[model samples]
Target: MARRNHTTELGSIACDDLTELGAGKEGWLVDNPNLLTALDTHSLAIANHSVVLVLDWSDGSDPTGPRVKIRPTLSPIESEYISSVEWLVFDDIRVLALGTSCGYLLIYSLRGDLIHKQIVNPGRILKLRVRGTKRDLTEDTSSAEICVVMPGVVARFDGSEIQSMLQRWFQETHSQFWDQKKNPVDSGSSNVRLPYQLWNVNKYGSCADAAITGIMPPPLMELQSSQRYYCAVTIGDDAVISAFRLAWWDFTLC
Candidate 1:
């Protein structure tokens, strides 16, 4: 079993994952929604809208800014829950991509002070996979592209190109978690390692099949501004905490 430990924050954090809930029992933001507890200076946004949900848990007090309510983007058409979110940079403007639990990607613009929402079509694909990893740390499209991984398949959006890189990369880079286990019953032959299982995305576009992994699991939705990125995530039933760096995107494409 894995567990998460909470850290102190600047003041208050905003609701990103849970709309009206906190993380865990021993956690500060435990089961807290709409309000952040013990978080550092961080911000949250979905797609492209004007106002950024900024948080600064540094003061260890209450928020001083004007109260803002995060209302769900309601519509007559039903939509699935959001699975992952990524922040992109385009020259002078900022872009947002909210990966839905149903495999749809919503694009937004965060230039100046407003957010503009738009839907993107992946064309022929019936389902899409959206997830983020802290390992990719570039200021380019590597971090921004929603890398779709399937059985022996990996594709990414590179400008007008849907490139296949993960298939080759996984064959060359990723592998089974433990290959050194010579004996299972022999406790002395092997040591207990962190749960780093490689899980695929849900079929209906939800993040259902996404299992826990690694000693310190990263957050699903990551917010980035300028050169910094902040993440709030957990591992197993007990949530862990950490911040990660992400790759920048190419805003050269209009």
Candidate 2:
């Protein structure tokens, strides 16, 4: 982990403390009253963080601009390769969920201790979301509930059989991602637009070219007209912000 320290005397720092990093060190530190509660492949949903947060690159504007800092009092997650974090809608509150490269889906409390750790193997979860498919005009609309999209497949969790299905989907999916030529087939010329249309785990099958290629689908789809999704904001291993339209899944209404 990287380390740096700043000294404060009376809620303010001496100007001499500003060395190479910048004068706006204080500006980079914002407080979150609440943090995210859930994690999936695409993004983490946070609570008590802010009503509306802007994720633009700061160019390291220290004490003069807005930036955020993790709760100094809290310990970081034990795992190092956390790919993504998100908030899931639970009852009336948001919960933080973390996705790890070691195929772990960890649920944590606001204080950041692991509360639930489920092994979602094979594929590393890059995104997660709930689908409330709207009914077609020919079908009844009142009987619908939400379904979960893990990595390669989507399924309705009944508190029993869903986890098993999700595990199978995630593993096969990861295997497929790692084994590139087996899935993509034709490389750049291939027309296999992803996110596994209809959850077919092995459309191509396992092969020799398996690696962590960064090519994947868009993060979140259900836009809600007013929400924002954050992507990488920098070049070559940096964070960026991107936005998209959230389309309501239409075929699953039955």
Candidate 3:
């Protein structure tokens, strides 16, 4: 009974400490109802406007500061703030991806190092989504995509671009040389960006959230197996649910 009470007290203390840490400068987490959190195989991440705290995954008691504390440097003139966060996991590594109110995507390493930053849209990004699609089993082919969701727009980013960048980053042996040229902005070819499409889904209704759920062989058409179509879905306060068939020519309201 004594041990149980002691454990309970310790738990309460830890909870209070965590709340304080997550409260940012406001001293109350409730002040920002949109506080972001993400969980993956490695750790749990919590984010305030410009700061991200990563908690180590453990089943045993150990006292240590957060595994990582990433506070993105914001200029005094910038009013952008973090709005969403997600864990981007690859087979060998994972990184934290965050979206901002002013339309930026920031990727950071687990060691709290900023790896990449780019503007995703002109509006607030509501969610940073990572999804995988299996094209075929025997063909041993698959693809992963990142969906940046805004109020009325959903942009699809090819995962291979970011994956290729991280591959070169991890294997680079020359620290000084890579550091000078690592920023994609410095080199246009290695910009970690490729051809991408931003699908408009606001025609049906103002979407609170949206994404390309999946891509499958063109429906109700006798076309080559190489042809694929996107299934775009959205939800909003005005419209409970809406879907569209997206293609090169146009988006079919369905």
lDDT of 2 by residue, 5-31 (tens): 686332222233232223355543244
Q: Would you give me the overall lDDT of model 1? A: 0.31
The Cα local distance difference test for each model comes to 0.31, 0.32, 0.71
The segments of candidate 1 whose C-alpha lies over 4 angstroms from its true place after superposition are 1-19, 23-62, 67-79, 109-155, 159-254
Clashes of 3: 0
User: Candidate 3's residue-wise lDDT over 82-195, tens digit each?
Assistant: 889999877777888888888877888777767777776778899888899775777877668998889888888778777877766666624545555343333222355444
Q: Write the per-residue lDDT of candidate 1 for residues 145-192, one digit (tens) a residue.
A: 344322211234432111122222223222532344222122111121
Stretches of candidate 3 exceeding 4 Å from the true structure: 1-32, 58-62, 75-78, 173-191, 219-225, 248-254
The 10 consecutive residues of candidate 2 with the worst lDDT sum are: 228-237
On TM-score, the candidate that comes out on top is: 3
- Model 2 regions more than 4 Å off: 1-80, 133-200, 204-254
lDDT of 3 at 96: 84
- Rate residue 130 of model 3 by lDDT: 88
